[model samples]
Target chain A: MRSHRDFARGFRESLAGGPAPQNATAQDPAEIERRFDVYRNNVAHGLTQALARHFPAIERLLGADCFRGLARAYIAEHPPRTPVLTEWGGAFPAYLADEPSLQSLSYLPDVARIEWARSRAYHAADSEPIAPERLQETATRAGTDLCLDLHPSVQVLQLLTPAGSIWASQQPGGPAPPRAKEWRPETLLIARRGISHVITSVVRSSTGRFVSALRAGDTVARARDRAGADFDLNAALLLLVENALIVGAGIETGDES
Target chain B: MTLPRKAGLGFKPEHFPAITETKPDLGFFEIHAENYMGAGGMPHAMLERLRADYALSVHGVGLSIGGPDPLDRDHLARLKLLCDRYDPESFSEHLAWASHGGVWMHDLLPLPYTAETLSLICDHVDEVQEHLGRRMLLENPATYVLFDDSDIPETEFLTEISQRTGCGLLLDVNNVFVSCVNHRQDPRAYLEAFPLNRVGEIHLAGHEEEELPSGPLLIDSHGREVAEPVWALYAEIVSKTGPLPSLIEWDNDVPDFATLMAEAKRASMILSGDHHALTS
Candidate 1:
């Protein structure tokens, strides 16, 4: 019997178009090659389909052929580390950022970041959103000690390019994204709308910072101060409440929980 | 709970709304266990709704039950979490391995049928049954290649695993046809040797054929309607097994809910047909 170690190595090598392992069969060499090609094609094709599903905007922007090529390269270098494909593409945005071929499309990586965040938000834990009335009651009671806990699905992306707009444009009903005349930074907030949908919107940089500070365990007063005068704390709070992005409210006794 | 002796379809999220609205008559809905292993959100919500309407079979594709390395404990833990949450009527995994050297290939790769692997697979099955606290049905693989070192016949190998680990079998008729044709063997003969008494569920799916100098090679691509020959094989099995909770698996290029239900309806017809024939 062939040792599993030997079979694993040979099969892995054969998937990359190497010679079929000797122990695989005693059939004609041509039959072996063709049969083994199915396994090779299955791996490449299956993983590529998974990537396309997770990052449809990337596939659309790059076109089908270009996306397949890119996906092949990424699969070759970073095959899924786990069986859960939802967790498999976390490194893809970084992979795109480091790719020399895609350097011309500088915003592609940031757009990919937004796509990944949307996927994450779609699968994030369910939480009951704190209602505006409850939030106000808590604020009145806790006063300056009030702290906010963002929903588990809420994610803020502070991007170097207007990727929030780019990702949104590629969505099913979104407008065609503008062709960039100049590179500018963009901030986006991602959160689940109920359990069945995810919402992505471009937001002011100050609002992004405000959410970030609150996510980092800052009190409502402190996070609002960090957002500077330009940040409308009320508006940000309203957005969070309306989007069901606030999961909890507590009093911070100078100790981060 | 056991899956009803009727027809079911692989649960696709795109059809969630349609399924919920119409509440199609299905025996059970089978979901890939790995798809719901995430922390939460829409997948769970959709599944929760469907679970109320139908029995569920949590089929796992990522357990790597036949891999050379030790079974992934974290993956098992995740499966446990899902099974505990859903308490599915049935749980199943493939006889093939999908991961090696920490890299998951996302496809079920074949393994040599030998004493070495037989023992390895039995141990893994035992561990899974012990961990999940229930018997898991092991589905046979659809392979395009054979191994020179395989001393045990695939049927005997599966039977031995079941005997050793006390696990039931998931007889995928399409797989039997695909492997038998790809290997130039007879599908009926393979089914004859299969342990039908221990089979808890049955699977029927579509396959694509590629011309080869030797003959036509059948690829188990679950992307279309169930083919006639595969349906014939399924009918033969149903005749023998008496309508054991069959499922129509159309994973890729999934048609709309009506098309999927059409496939399941055909299976239901055959199941009822066989029951009538037997009783008469």
Candidate 2:
């Protein structure tokens, strides 16, 4: 039987470029490292490629060498448990937050956070965005509590790190990603706009109203009071509707009204 | 207008756009099925474009076919979804390995070819076939170590698995070189023992060798061009195996798209070398 200790030790060694298990035969110790190097190289490069696939923006932000260095460190800190690598690196954003080397680029964690959302949105459930008929029925329910069900692929990321703009400027056809200080910490609304994932900077004026209304299924009027600002109800509804992220909605007749 | 069957290249993300842009005439393309399992995204969209233009193969690296634990249901379901989506020309995975006992290793781990392991692998292969609703070709594994108590040779074990499961075999020539050198066995013996009739695909990869004080061990790194010895073995296998659907696999340190196609072209010439002379 393969002991847990032996497996763990071998795994660590494999990650660290050390000797693999001498389980096969009493061969030279150097032989273990020599042979193990292939697996080692594979593990590192495979994960690196997977990471790059997951976060193409990050790969572009930090050139290949820097990305490789970041990837190597991330691998050392969080080795992958599943062979299904597309979903690996779930903890990388958190890992980025604590990485001292990234402290200089203080908003790097938020960038990673946004990148991870892109990964999740890319693979999230495939559901029809809110159909027009459903939205009409919900709005027409007489004397009932209105509710809005967000699209499964929708994510509302609240970061104080100015990442939404960073994500945008980095888009393939968009202008080159703006430099630091060109933008400030802000909120973002990301949704799978068809097959493409789109990130938009949540205008400072509307961020508060959108988050509360979207999450709590609040009445449009009630949501306005909560934010206490001139929220553009027309533009707000258009944002959700035009993007086709409004998947499900309902109205409760027997509420505490 | 179409890709040949002699030898193909494994397509990675970096080469996706270029391959489409260049429209090179080569053999089919192979991709890991699991990578394209998402509902609909870049991999599938691009793959659709490629599929429209080329013969395709969907090779899997994570089925965990010989482990002590139950096979992963979710992974299998997703793989099935991919198979249904792509309806690939050929599909294949590794032999002599099991990654998951409970948690998956992700990397292919070794199994001793004992009766217990053989039964276990057959069970897993059966499950894979039942779930995918189609037979998958099994590739031989590259190894770093060998167990003393292994009762059967890896090829014989693979042959038995193929015979029992009715699955095809994917003969990876580089793995033959790596395992033979690491275990100090004759590569030719392995080729001789392999059930050539069952072979449905061929794989060529580069391996790195490091000499030890005891003996040198060749690692199936797949990070370089096909080694000379491995190329020689590929020639032998192709001549015997008779123009199988071969792939040149360079998964790491992937060079520009042209480099991969160049290597695939080399394998194509070798496979169809009745008229072409060996490179001097």
Candidate 3:
């Protein structure tokens, strides 16, 4: 039987797409190389497909061939460690953000990030959606420093460009995305309302204020207040309502305090 | 009771309607456990409808059974839950590979069958069987490369693990052909010494060969029909093990159900008079 140490050693070598057949004759190194390349190709292809599935918008923006080549290179450098394809390529957006070659495509990284968030939201576990009436009840409770629970599948990402618009433009029948002169960081809430992830643009000011307030552990009203002079309660509330993002809130009653 | 000694097909959600309507006399249907991990969806709904008529086996592709890292605890838990849900006629996983290191690779990777590998994999199988409170079938891997560090032959390693862990085998005939041809070993020699009595299931799939300047190397692509030579090996295997529950595995560019069924018919033809000693 092969020892655990040897087993581990062989695994390290085999997994790296290394020279497995040490006994290959000089006359046929090319044959062994070609045979082994098939395995490498399959591994690379599988990871590329996973990335494509995870970042559909990025693939679409780059066109099929270019995207595939980039993905192939990315996979060879960073193969997934886990077997769950859903969890694979979570770092790909950051990778794209750091790639020197992709430096020219400044807007590309943000779009990839948005796409990754959408993929996560699409597959995240289902959570209960707090009913609108729950808010009304919380509103009535005195000294209730209301804090709402975000959905498990919900991700709020702030990006440098209108990635939502860019992602939209690449879809069938959509216009090309407006250039970065339209470049202003936008907040997006990606969440699974019922079955699939739904993405919508959140006003930048409200997003920053909301995140800051949430970090400070303040009430919803206090967070909205942080949105500064231009904070529009009606618009933010309407956006939350439309997206079905408000799960449930707990009032910080004085008695609990 | 042992699974019937007949050929079966891997069940895809797309084939539920036609399979149920036709009620082909397959030995069993195998499904990837991960695909059915959803709480309630079309895959489950269709599987529930189909399981009412066909014997079902759960084949897990994401268990990461032979990884250097400890067996994925949550993955094992989830698989245990699935086993409880399906109460499948049988269950199996691969012996040759680990896909995910921290994550899943979604493909079966090849592992060297060293003593260490034997013990590690045996432990994994033991844990799985303990969690599910039943025996689990472990399948051999087909490989394009042979690790220089491998000290034991594949069959010996598998047999030793089976002996120690009390797990059964899911022998893939095409894998034997592919690996044997790739490594220049006798496919018949591998089969002749195989522990047929402990083999709970069999798998047959198609492979393709790319001719290089040095020689022809077989790739276990499973994208087409099982070749004539592979069928001959299957016949020889069945003649020994009698017959085991067999599946026609086609994961890439899967064709229509009729195509799979037709391929299955060829396997079924070989099982006409055979019977596994253990089950039959």
Candidate 4:
């Protein structure tokens, strides 16, 4: 008589390609083994489906059979920690980066990263965008000392390859951009503007640096400084305001004496 | 908490536009709770529009209610938030577990029917209902393997849970057929013993048959149209239950909206006692 805990442990082990537990009930031992195999297959297949759903672009890039094989290996290595299937593949991008055999597709991991970011942005918490007047008032009050809070769905990605464009090309109705002759570092900004809408844009490296600094809680002047002399702070600020990406803005008036 | 006694279709994102445009005469639309758990996005927007038109049923697939560990409170809170947002007419989850020790197994796994397992599931159901501030219907699971320590029958197990937790049953006829075929039991007998009076909803889905060396194993794939045998079984159960809210569930290999509507129409005819459709 196995305890429920013991049974669950055994069952999970079997699903992960371990030997079947002796307690599985059936008319015959062979039948039990055969049925357990079906159960294992289902578990594997279901996880594979979940991973495939999250990484559709990766699947398109790698082809179905290749992606499935990679997904199986990935699943075995990093089973989901949460019951939420949508939140299951957070580690896949990093996992792809570590896979030795996939060295040829150097951009695969970054593409996975962008896909994961898109997924997070799509499902991220909803927030009311800061009104333009409020942003302006804060800007006036603190000038260089003003800090801005981006929406919960905002994601800034800096990649060594054009993975963002590659992912966009895979999207429906999106024409594939010609592959760059040389590796060009790309910066991507992703955010959800509407309940079901996600907006992804390729931005200049300066804009990405500025947004990243703001996201790190830097004041407007500090963020602009971090973006360097070439960065267009006003244009970046306009972009953030127009897109409703900034959810909160505040001024730190320290000891007005 | 009641849905119209007509057929409904599982809502899929791919058919969102068509469904919104046509507004098919579905009694209600059911969606997996996990799919809509995201904070905000198109899924919620579309669901908002659909919720305005149709009675919604939140069918949860990842609650892991029968697991060894305590219920995931965060997941529960999220589920509660979604239910509160939608005010769905009904909410349901499967009898099986999909998570153990914080690791989520994507497929619903079976557990032995014992005092410990029964108590565990009853506590989970209680927690879920209390957290959601509503009664939930628990559907029977499709299992390929049985446990040696299971002293109680599946029906009695479910009956005890329902009686103890004061929850309704979600009788998935396809699951009954698939599990019975896999376990070499009679589907009709399972349905006979089922507390159909307590059934709040019925699920009809397609299954795939995998030939094993031992015998034919039925997998509850839900990727195709309802098979004839499952349909007959559903008709038998529905005839007994007198048209419980039934849903056509096509989760994988999902066909176009027209195919789903046609299937829903078929179920609707059966629910309406139109024997002509059954014969056709």
Reference-based lDDT, each prediction: 0.89, 0.74, 0.74, 0.88
lDDT of 1 at B135: 93
TM-score of each: 0.97, 0.81, 0.79, 0.94
- Residue A83 lDDT in candidate 1: 96
Highest-DockQ candidate:
1
2 or 4, greater by lDDT = 4
Docking tier of model 3: it is incorrect
A137-216 per-residue lDDT for model 3 (tens digits): 87667343777666666666777777777877877897787885886767777666765545645466566567456545
By the TM-score metric, which is better: model 2 or model 4? 4
User: What are the per-residue Cα lDDT tens digits for candidate 4 across A1-257?
Assistant: 56788888888998888877767877556878777887788888888988887889999988999998998998888998877788889999999999999998888998999888888988888788888788788879887778899988888999988887888888899876546584587889988885656778889988999999999888888888898767987789888877888899898667533
Candidates arranged by lDDT, highest first: 1, 4, 3, 2
Q: Between prediction 1 and prediction 3, which has the larger TM-score?
A: 1
Tell me, per candidate, how large a share of the native contacts it keeps: 0.80, 0.36, 0.29, 0.78
- Candidates 1 onward: DockQ, in order: 0.78, 0.34, 0.22, 0.68
Docking band of candidate 4: medium
Best by TM-score: 1
How high a TM-score does candidate 4 get?
0.94
Model 4: pairs clashing at backbone N, Cα or C within 3 Å: A195-B41, A195-B42, A196-B41, A196-B42
DockQ for candidate 1, please give it.
Answer: 0.78
